[model samples]
Each structure stands twice: as structure tokens, then as C-alpha cells.
Target: MSDIPQERRVVTAIPGPKSQELQQRRVAAVAAGVGSTLPVFTARVDRGIIEDVDGNRLIDFGSGIAVTSVGASAEAVVRRASAQLQDFTHTCFMVTPYEGYVAVAEALAELTPGDHAKKSALFNSGAEAVENAVKIARAYTKRTAVVVFDHGYHGRTNLTMGMTAKNMPYKHGFGPFAPEVYRVPVAYGYRWPTGAENAGPEAAAQAIDTITKQVGAENVAAIVIEPVLGEGGFIEPAKGFLPEIVKFANDNGIVFVADEIQSGFCRTGQWFACEDEGIVPDLITTAKGIAGGLPLAAVTGRAEIMDAAHAGGLGGTYGGNPVACAGALGAIETMKELDLNAKAKEIEATMKARLTAMQEKFAVIGDIRGRGAMIAIELVKDPATKEPHPEAAAALAKACHAEGVLVLTCGTYGNVLRFLPPLVIGQDLLNEGLDVIENAFAAL
Candidate 1:
């Protein structure tokens, strides 16, 4: 539907001369710690394709790290955000509340899980939303301890860095994290000490036991989890894991928070991934895909818990800026109009079938997991050992990039090759991208 050609066009080599030049400029200007998966500077994006500075069009498998679920150039999103931009860029919503922000809150309250009376607060990024959610949880419960799962990625801020599990890129050398944050085991099936089938009940029991003995469930303010783990290799917790956790939280006074930042907003087949098990949380944090690639995030929760915070305790200068809110409203509209949830299911089926076939052919593919469009393959050196093979993941991503497909790698061990194509991607283009990945694996 978009005027831009929907096919991958490699007129030049990956990270061609123009991108190389830009990369050099970036090295000189940008911070060293900030990295790029593909060093190709983007000139434009049309639907699921990213046209780079060198005029090569690449299929987008990473939607700006799962932010652009409605596609970058979605008509309604562009139209509404642009209209807001023309009207006014930013008046500081804190100084003068706007209709757009309230509309976004209303949309989140309706869309996020739970039927009980709910309230919503908006923020600039996933990290900010998480920080506020923690504050709100503590305020409501009058507790100090916070519990997070291993292999979970919350964000990069000081507090969230403490909550995250990865070491190298995210939490390395950054120490003296905020106090009172505790880490417990997640239902990482593939790597579970025991077999994966028992990972659900066993891991949940272990985690709950840890909380009960060490952290004391009564003193814990929040138990935050990503229903479908994102940066930690797209690990979907075992079947019985979440329900058990939710039950314990309800039994105690602890707030159960679903950090649906990366997994929310139809990135999964459902509007939110938590719906798969019907496990609703006390507070759900959402961002990334909420605002058509704009920087917007939200914390929607029960009214009693949300109201625990003072009137001015939950806002920021740029939180829910009018332009970002307009984009969010437009994104919600697009999701409904296009029925992206169904599209995500279609993607899941296609990916599961093809990747399962790949697993049959390749010994390195130890696991193929994830739900909806947020799928991944865990590579290992040996099937029996299941030793992490970050090398193969790196090589496969590079091969896909060489053929004009933009793929991404993640995981605690960096052995996960994640695919997050835009929901609006043409079936033909998505297949072509998958074909390139298949070929890349064949080469390996």
C-alpha cells in the first residue's frame, strides 16, 4: 500500500559507502557505550522496510527494538502526530494538562488487562514508567522490598539497571544499584536445571520459597515480571508459573506488576501477552509499541493502588507530550482498524513452522520459542550439552544483514536471534525476509 517499493533492494553492500561515512561521524560524536546492531544510518522507513543512507532497502525484523508495532509510517499515526506537531510541540503537560494525554490514559485503562476500576499514568520511556510504578507500589503497600526475575530486562536507568539481569552490555561495571531490589529465578525452560516440562511448577515454587524465606512476602512491595521475557531471549515462562506467582501475590499484600514494556501493544497475538494465561497484574507497565515509535510509556493499575501516590508524584515535563499522545491514540486506532492481533497470530504461525523446520535441519538450534511476532531461536554448540553459542547467533545476524534483512540478537548469553517484524509487513516480504534467514542458517 505504501508508495515505497516493498521489496528488499541491495543496490550496494551492507553498510555501504554512505553508511560507512555516517558511522565514522557517529564514532566521533556519539558516546562509545551506545552501540548499533547494523551500522547503516536510516534515511527513511516505509512500512516494514528501512531505506538507509546508501539507498539500499532492508527488511525490518527489528521494529526499532519493538517500538513501531503499527509500522513507522502508519497513516493515522503520521497524520495525527503531524497535526499535533503543527498545533504545538510541547507546553509541558505538567504545567497545563492536555486532552491528548488523558485520552492516552483512557485508552490504556481500557486496553490493558483487568476489568476492575483502573487508573493510568504516562511517562517518557519504559524506564521512567517502571521507576514510577515502583514508587507507586511502595507508596500503596508501605513496603520496601521489590522482587524481579532473572533474565528480565526492565531498562537502563539506575533503578531499572538494578532490576535487570544481563551483565555485559546492560549492567556491567555499573554497581551500587538501588537498595531493596532482589533477584529470583525465572522459568527459563531451555536452560532449567531440571527438564523443561517441570520448569513451571518447580521454578515458581522455588521463587515463591525464596520470597517467603528471604524477602518475606509481607515486606515485598512489588513482584515485576515480563509475561513474555524480551531481552532475555524471548523466554515464555512455563505454563503454571505465572498463575502461581499471581496467586501468591494476591494472597500476600505484594503488588504483582507485569512489565509489558516490550511484550505489550499487540507485539504478541493478544493486545497484551498476559492474556495468554488470563493472569492479570495489579500494575501493568507498557511502552515501546504504544505510540507509533514515539517516546511514550504508561503505568495502568487499580484505582486504589494508583491513588496511593500524591497528586503531583507521578508526572514529568515531557511525559505524555501532546504529540506523543496523539501518536498513541493514532496507534490504538490503527491496531483496531487493521486487526493487528490477528496479523500477529499469522506471523507466529509462519515463524513457528519455518523455524521448526530450520531446527530439524540444524543441530545448532537448541530451542525455538516466543509468542506472536516476537519469536527467537536459541543457538547452542551441542544439542546434548545445550551450550550457548553466541558465535552462531552473531554469524547468522551478519549473514541476514548482508542480504538486506535487518535482524537482531539478544539473550543473557547473547545466543538469541530475535525477529520483530512490523505488524503491517506484507506476507510476501515477511517470507522473503525469512528465506534470507534460512539461507543464512544454511550457510552456517
Candidate 2:
């Protein structure tokens, strides 16, 4: 059905001559601040494989950091976006409104969690969506303080950087961030100071106490969080944690915001990870997979909260670009037609089973967590101590890359090997990638 071969093939060494040349060019042309997980130059990407310039077909487990959940070359996305491209590239939606943008907004209203009358504003990246969400929340609640969790990652913008928890790489040296942003502990089950069973109640109580004593719940505008933490070791908060926080927000009149940028769009088995706990956020920010592979993001939320922003208070020159909107429509169509949510569940089952089995063999796997296609394994030196093994994670990823299997590592400690294979990837190819990962662990 797909033209791209659903298999892994290594014709030359990883980052072979052509990719090496491109890396050199990238060094010259690209900013040093811009970093890439893998240096292989892509010639084509379709379904579950990324073909390099050297003709190496690597089984892709990164999905361009979970942006291609509907596959890089899904027919619907290509057909609709291509049609739009031939007509017009950009009129700047604010300058001259377009049907495509409105259509996308309507679709997001229906697709995102909650049946309440909703509205949406599009943006160019996850960070922009998050920033706008905070703006909208503050406007609606008429408050200034914003609350985020320990492992949460919102975006790279100054406001988001202040909201983000990690310091190195993201927040390092980028100081004097926005004010009124508060950080609270996340109920990370594996690394919780207390046992997993106690993580939820303990963290929730502590967070609520902190908010009450320090920020004053009355002054808090929003409680923003990722349903499943991304780029922070794919940490899934302990059970009951989200509901507790949501209850607090509801009781305190604080707008609850779900930063589903990396965990939405059917990547988490459910349409959005918040659905897992039946939490209806006042606002939800989305990107990464919203427009297939196109750069688009949106803040979809309760109509009342969304409308709190005055007319012309929110928008971007490139927000909801016609072509990107078309891609989003196509992507949503593909998601429904193909039943990608079910596929994501299947992917989760397969990945969890395999990773669990590998954990039995390799004690370095401290934890295997995440939902559906957004899975990861945290690496550690000893199971007892649970000391992060970032070096091993890096080494294993490198080995997988060398063997024509593309993987990514992420975490606060940089010790997580995250797997975000395209949902359309064949089972055989998926298993092969796992095999490569297992072999990498074995070699280590």
C-alpha cells in the first residue's frame, strides 16, 4: 500500500560520507545553538522509515519527535496540502481570513477533549500555543500567578522557559525569565522520594500547600501540566495525581491547562492523555502532530475562557496558514479513517511488552513508562540505587543509530530512550527496531 519499503537497510556506515558532508555544511550554516539528535541527512521519510542520503533506510522510532504520527507521507495530508499549495501559499489569516483556518478550528473543537462549547486560536509552534494559553488563562481568571510541575516542559520562549523546570540546555543562562511563574513537584512514580503508592497524595498535598502558602490560590491564574511528561523521561504522573490537581484548580477557580503538545493527537492511545483520567481541562495546547508534519499549533479551550481575550488580542501572521490547515484536515481525516487511536494502543501494548521483557534481561532499564506510541525507558546504573545512567542511554541510542535504527534519548537526567515510531509503522518493522534496541542493550 505504501511506496516506501517498510524495512530497515544499512547500505553504509551511519552518518555516511554524504551525511557527514551535510553535517559539516550544517555546522557552517546553522546556528550552534540548534542541536539535532541524529546527524544523518534525510533524503526521504515515509511511514516508519527515514532514508538517508547514503541510502540507509533506518527504522524511525523518533517520528521527528512525534510530529509524524499519521506518517510523514500520509496520502490525505499530502493531497490536501499539495492542493492548497498550488492555489496560494499565504494571505496571512489575520489580513484576509480563510476557510481552511476556520475549518481547522472547528475540527479542533470537536476533536480535543470535552464537549463544552469550545474555541481555538492557531499558532506556529507548541511554545506559541502555550504562551497564548497562559495569556488567555490570565485574562479569563484576572490573575497573575501561573503554576507548573517539576518535570513539565512547555516551550523555549522566555515565558515558557520560566514555566519549564529543567535548567540545563533549556533554561541555562536564559535568566530573568517572566515573573509570577511557580514550580511545584510532579508525582513521578519511579523517582518519587516516597514509594509510588504515596506519590500522588503526597505530591498533591505538598503542591496545594505550596500554592496556598506562597502564591495564594486566589491569585493563581492557571495550573498548567503535561498529562504525560515529555522530554523529561516520558514520566507519567502517579495515578490519581492529575485528578487531584484538577480538583484543586476547579475548587480554586484556577484555569486548568493541559499542555498536550507531545501527548495529544492520538499519540497517547486516547485522543488526548487527559481523557485517560477523565480530566476536562479549561484549556489545552497542542502541536507536534496536529498537522501531520506541518508546523502548526493551537490552543483549544472552553468558549468562555477563550473569548476572554479581547478581539485581536491573539493571533500570528502565520497562525493557521492555509497549507498547514489543509494538512491538519488531512491528518484528522487519516486519523479517523485509519483509527489511529486503536493503532496507538496496539503500539503501546507491543512496545510495553517488549520493553518489559527487555527489562527482565537488562537491569539498567530503571523504568518503562508512557502510553501508546509515546513510550520510553529510563536507564539507570543499579536497580536498587536507581542512579541515572545517561551515558548508557546515549551509548545505546548511538548503537541503535549505527545499526540503522533511529532512536532518541530524553529526560531531566538525559537517561531516557524514547520511542515515538509513526503510528502507521508495520509490526514487523517495529519489532525489528526493538530487536536493534535489545541488541544494543545486550552489547552494552
| Best model number under lDDT | 2
Clashing pairs in 1: none
- Candidate 2 lDDT over 122-228, as tens digits, reads 99999999999999999999999999999889999999999998898999998999999999988999998889999999999999999999999999999999999
Superposition TM-score, candidate 2 onto the true structure: 0.99
Range of the 10 consecutive residues with the lowest summed lDDT in candidate 1: 1-10
Query: Residues 63-123, candidate 1, lDDT per residue (tens digit)?
Result: 9999999998889999999999999999988897779988888888899888999999889
C-alpha RMSD values across all candidates: 1.0, 1.0
Going through the candidates in the order shown, the clash numbers are 0, 0
